[model samples]
Target: MKRSSRNYAEGESPRERIVNAARRLFGSKGFYATTTAELAEEASVSVGQIYRLFTDKDDVILAIVEENVRVRLAEMHSIFDAVERRELAMFEAIKAIAANSLHNEDGSLFYEILAEACRNPTVAERFEKQTAFYRDGIRRLAALARPDVPAAELEAYGDVMMACFIGLGHRTAMSPPVDPEATSHSTACLMMRALGLAELESGRVQTQP
Candidate 1:
């Protein structure tokens, strides 16, 4: 993971500290239970400091959600860029997609906020925008993968991919620790079926774990 260049100076930005602390704490405790006071303590600042940086707990959560979306979108775009550049084989690309969804730092937080957004309006807006971004990214990639498909149908295909991705994310979010690679391979196979692509005759997908 790349560290931010922001120095731990005499007067470091409160917002940066709060965001970093929130990312770390929320990754561990989740959104519903992680309190503002706890976040303040984690940030090494007072609760009022948190308020100064953000309007309220929801605002802080929104900032976290936005940051999470920014990172995940960038990561997905990178993988898609490799696909666009023909730098990765189809199977290798699918693996990269799977690895990114489950293994990336912000992915967990993305899903956490998404789940919470079910009840919270502020979070829901961010979640909706995040969904749109992924849908757009997927549509672009699906078009690149199969140019013969109509644009409208390709858009639906993109939606299907997003659905599969979300399902994979939720499976990982559940307890008992689901296997990301297996889930991803299964999803890729299903996508192949949907696209009428040739599946492996051996019905084999290499498992990473």
Candidate 2:
């Protein structure tokens, strides 16, 4: 495929391109492995264009993380909406969470940044804040799904769910070509089992008519 021109100027769509390129590179390679030059090359722009749009590579990374969080929050809201009116089972909600969290290019990229954040305080702080936001989201979602469950238990469950997500992220980063669908199915089953849902606890997720 022919790359776009090197022409970089204000008011153009270079910023968006740069963001997208950075996201792809960071997701595929990793934060540490990705360079500004690579981001520019992927976007078919110049390195100076990236600097003009952002302060540095970390700034671009932060933007990517923020955008990722925004997208996930939107996904969570949609999931909440779908479950709000109906008599959906708890396992169903677990399934929805697992399905949404696990199946995505964005999730894969987020894991890359997450691994880098472990060593850098700036990165780590940003990641922690994002995780907290997600935890709070899970907490609220869990409460809504299971009103009978205690608030404390809901919080604990949310933490457990987040822990499971991070562990899955690590697995995906290490594994070659992570299978999103399989991971989602496995996670939903595991979560249901952990919640002591007897039928689901058996790890059989096939829905019978």
Candidate 3:
């Protein structure tokens, strides 16, 4: 109950304020537990303004998740681009991408949204959109890493890799890694092996000397 609250309206638009307030309140309280009145109060906006900006609290939650996905997808694109341009190594890119997935700073907010997705078709659709992007990206990465492999086979690898990243986010949210860098690198290795793209790296493998 004793948590710091930020000025939800500090230079943000009415809609942004409402979404921000909902993210904090819904994450802390819950979707059904929090009300429009509470969102209005936290956002420092009139109740009417909240309604005008969003159809309901569900709308605000959708906005929050959509924004989150948008930023994350952009980052993914950047990492994929770097790999394509040879600006980053394939292993390093996978490690960077896996590390990015572990950022769950909002704690249970991600879980709350996941629950919301299960109950709400619209929210679920947004989640599906994110999954499609990730799956496609994985398939593309696989093709580049193992050009000899057929696309159909790579498609299956993409689905499994996507699941791994998604599950990793949920897992790390509950039990954070002690050494995130090591975790990410290990994840990269596992994922690479999954795509038949494994490679040997010195000093990384545990050498029982």
Best by lDDT: 3
- Model 1 RMSD vs true structure: 6.6
Local accuracy of candidate 1 as per-residue lDDT tens digits, 1-209: 23334455576677979888888778788876898888877777788777777887767778876675677678778877876676755555666676566664555676677677888887688667866776777776677656777778888878887777666655554645667778678767667667656544553322221
Question: Which digits, one per residue and each the tens of the lDDT, describe model 2 over residues 1-209?
Answer: 34655554666488778888887788778777887777878888787778888988777877887877787778776777766755455566666667665555666676666667876788788877876777777776766645667778878877887787656645544566656777776777777666645344543333322
TM-score of 3: 0.84
Scored by lDDT, model 2 comes in at 0.70
What 10-residue stretch in candidate 2 is worst by lDDT? Answer: 200-209
Candidate 1 residue spans exceeding 4 A from truth = 1-13, 24-32, 104-112, 199-209
Q: Residue 27, candidate 3: how far off, in angstroms?
A: 1.3
Q: lDDT by residue for model 3 over 1-209, one digit each (tens)?
A: 22225554346787777777888898889889997788788877788888888887777877887787777778878987887787877778778877887775565787887798899998899777876765677677666665665777867766777787776666665874647688888998887666655455631222121
- Best-to-worst lDDT order: 3, 2, 1
Residue 53 deviation, candidate 1, in Å? 1.5
User: What lDDT is reached at residue 97 by model 3?
Assistant: 75
Clashing residue pairs, candidate 3? none
